[model samples]
Target: MEARSRCRLPCSYYMTCKCCMKRMDGKGKSFIRRTLGSTGFVQAVGTKAGPNGTTLVSTGLSDLDKIIGGGIPLGGIIMIMEDIEAPHHLLLLRYFLAQGVVHGQPLLFASPLTSPKSFLGTLPGLTKGKDSKGNVDLQKSGQSADGLRIAWQYQRYLNEQKALETRRQRQQEIASQSWASGRLHASSLSPNLSSSVTSGSLEYTGTFDLRKSMDQAMLNAVNTVCFSLQGETDMAPLHGQCAAFVTTHSRSVQEVPNVGRIAMQSIYAPQSMHLFSEWKMLSFLAWLKGIIRTANVVGLVTFPASLLKPSVLVRLQHLADILLSVEAVSDDHKEMEAMLTDYQDISGLLHVHKLASINTQVPSFPEASTYSIKVSRRKEVVLEHLHLAPVDVYGKGSGNAGAAQVLCSTPANAPSSLDF
Candidate 1:
């Protein structure tokens, strides 16, 4: 019995023998074992590695991207609560689709409008040779010729020259510091690093011109699919389309990963609201959230929050990875005019409700929850921090100040005024 017991292998020996061999092999023939290279994961255009190793795709608006903590992550859904009175949500949808088109990413756009394809024609074109502020350099455009011809422009020209000289000196100092820090030498060693930096600086997120439509040739080159939700009786067909689209661009099917964008405009618009039940709509969102969570796709859905019940709206908000709401500012509102310094420039207010917290526990909070959205030069959409107008002590121009004083002043008939 002792001999038989000794000949038999121990229970742990059988269980750990292969693991031990693997550990030994791992230590000795490390070179033989394959390790994922830098190029192992294909990076799609318009996408960047974000915090916590998450992949981020630009929201098309650079300011919006900054506000939302870099960009929207892959496999995430961005829900924008629409302003019922105005078509402000379309501005966001257009930019999102246009950016995808610019990056050569596949786009699936669905809208409740009768002819969704016609909406593509309204997409903003990429502005070439524009600075980060989406402004063309006046000097480069020969607009300085008028200044040269005028006698009064001499002082202005001298001031401009002084400013240019100061800028040049500052740039030279920065370059010298970079060289001194050995960063210039390190950057020179990696050709791709320099190339990527140049490309990123130039075209990381395209600045779009709202006045110009995308070139026909450029639009034709892109693979775009548009769907009209006008006749759809239920959400099943649309859900299927989304699923199929996601499946086509899924990581498992692609040899090289390519990002896909799905934009749905006015999901709960009155025109299509009758076609879908509240539960059905909720299910569709839930299903979409599930499918996109596994695939290399990002989705944007804009819906009229005013049309939906509070409970349903809350559920929708919870499902969204990022939630944003737009409120149109009334031009005639004296209070608003008095409150904002740039009242004429402001078109609407953008509220950041929830930011995407994918693959992480910590949530991203913007420096300010609200930003003023306005058109710059009537060409580009600009988002700026809301700046309050200076308070007028005399209450001459400030309507809000006058109203506040009137409210604070107690009436003679009031009990509080009579006693204290």
Candidate 2:
């Protein structure tokens, strides 16, 4: 009676005692049983399992990944609308390719240039330090000659420190909970998770230094296939090549799965536009999209939006799962200069038109749709929210000069610490 009340059953009689079986199984046993029959997902390097059974790969930029609701998912197409005057799209392409190289993933690079292989040489090398701060250089430490400048800069520094501390504490709490729950065990966890505890770690996405080129040895080790669309009169040959590449990386039960990245730079540029009609180009894109949809591959295509007609551009945008556009900021644009406080630091603007929504109905919306693209002193690309310049009572220029004068004229040397 005591054993029955405790719901303890012998192994031989386990089937007869439903209550005992349920008590012994626990939640972990149920999870294990559910997954036992299912074919496990590929847990490759530089990839993580996202919500809704989708796998995510980094876009080379950590901030960009966060903005796009965790990295780019496998089997999705990313389209970037190019700026007519600037090569900002190339920055995105370089970073995307560089990330694949770092992860040792197979790459298929197609470009309108005669020598697509040469573009690989210009890829930025990964930054040495593991710190994410390497991407943003804030001149916050040194005391400025101006009192107001010193106060304002230090205040910004304090705020950044607080943010970092809060983030660190949150990460620690998450790690503790994951460990306590035992939901992610060594045997159950994917190689992607076992290798890296947290997705935010440096192993997942690396910071790159734009000033330095990747090491020659590292570039030589990667399996890179480059195709030149400089003078190809027919889209058939390119389409065939892509088909073969996708076949090599297709998901299969027999073969060990690996991630593949396909990058097409300026696909509809002037050089290639003469060879194929708009219909042919659209057909090619549709075909490419179909092939990559099933395979464990992600494709990034950049085209000059200004050259295409509105109807054609709309069709192209609709084809992309993730759509982004870059706009160059003119140096002499007085109106923009007056509107943004950090006008001098702004190089361009990044607009996120769409985000990849795979295996789910709910669309992911970022906190901001537009972000300012800034190049740090170390040549690292950084994205930040645009801050409007402060307005005065008269609605003229920033009233910083008068405020600085008033603060500096105080009898006591500026209050030692910030209030907040």
Candidate 3:
């Protein structure tokens, strides 16, 4: 009988094939390596690295990262579409910048329209423990409400919970190191929605007050990559310049070895829109997308969907890997409350047009989520799924109504006394 041999791949050149890996030349090998390289310089921006090897990076909003796939992949672009009246999107931008600074990652903030400093000021001061708005004061220290002399049962329960939390946080610290030390994959959140680590996910290192001058070292680091540009029409050339600058920083042993994080903020603002013609804007983004995929770079851009025509925004949406739109909840608090009656609290609907690179291996990635950006004290900045009870009662209120009826069923009493 004749000896037979078979090759399974459609094409031997298909990357990742064992035979291909063996035969691959220097460039091919490098391509494969880069494809698998971890964006570990930054940690817990919300997403894990993909198997394809493109570096996964954080937006500096761990909450946002969790909602939008594993976090934005390096070489990926996020088009944050904000409302005309609402500036909540700016909060996310500040988080991104602050996150970069904290991680000591090289960041490029190019804003043709807004005052970079004023916008940067919006970043909230980093704190140790932040819970639901009302509960923050309670959980100020590691052991919240410590001053209160509570009963043993409740205290013991708290002790058990605290112990569990401590163990989880320890796990998070270990996991965070994986991403920081150039390991690509990470569990974005510990068992809880929030990260358990010390610094914690998306936590800013320090506060920035306009009254006080910025730190010398922090200022210098930001200055190295931040570009305050003029003459908006053609920024494609400037794109090349920025990429080169980032490359230089990443290679320099003197600077922190960080992955490049670029924030092309408000590119559609009036200051720069005229500079980029319809096709010119598209061309620039296309070039940008290519750069991020090949290099250790991830970009975040804000475009006012209101300013540009829908068609133009659609074109941009196509170019970007993820597109998020924010709308104001309502001017009237009562109106907002009435509108989102089912939810305990909701800021606005976070319409996510596209979400890619979901890590299915991780069970946290929900099959169906009513994604929203809630109005909370701490976790309010990014898009979060409106956390609801698994068994939604839908306002039936039978138990409460019965209790009320029992008390109120007595006939109307005189003003002096009513039935209890």
lDDT of each model, Cα atoms only?
0.72, 0.73, 0.53
Candidate 3: residue pairs that collide: 35-53, 36-53, 45-58, 47-70, 47-71, 75-292, 75-293, 233-275
For candidate 1, lDDT tens digit of each residue in 13-121?
A: 2111222222323543443224322212235555666665567788889999989987788888999999999888899999998888766678899998899989999
TM-score: model 2 vs. ground truth: 0.71
- Which stretches in model 1 have alpha-carbon errors above 4 Å? 1-42, 131-202, 393-420
Report clashes for each candidate as comma-separated counts. Answer: 0, 0, 8
lDDT of 1: 0.72
Q: Candidates' TM-scores?
A: 0.71, 0.71, 0.60
Model 3 Cα lDDT, one tens digit per residue, 1-420: 010111133331132222332323233344345534342322223323344444456676656766764567666788888787887677677767766654455667777644555545445434434324324554675344464666656877877877776565454444344433332223221222222233343322222222333333443444335555556446755777776854553433323334567887777777666766777777777877766655556788887788998898888888877777776665454423333443445556565666654233333333323356654554345456444333335964333433233213233353532343
- Compared with the true structure, the alpha-carbon lDDT of candidate 2 equals 0.73
Q: How many backbone clashes can be found in candidate 3?
A: 8
Instruction: Report the Cα RMSD per candidate.
Output: 15.7, 13.9, 14.7
Query: Which parts of model 2 are misplaced by more than 4 Å?
Result: 1-41, 129-202, 391-393, 396-420
lDDT of 3: 0.53
Model 2: per-residue Cα lDDT over 354-415, one tens digit each: 88887789988667667888999856899888776765457665544432331122323456
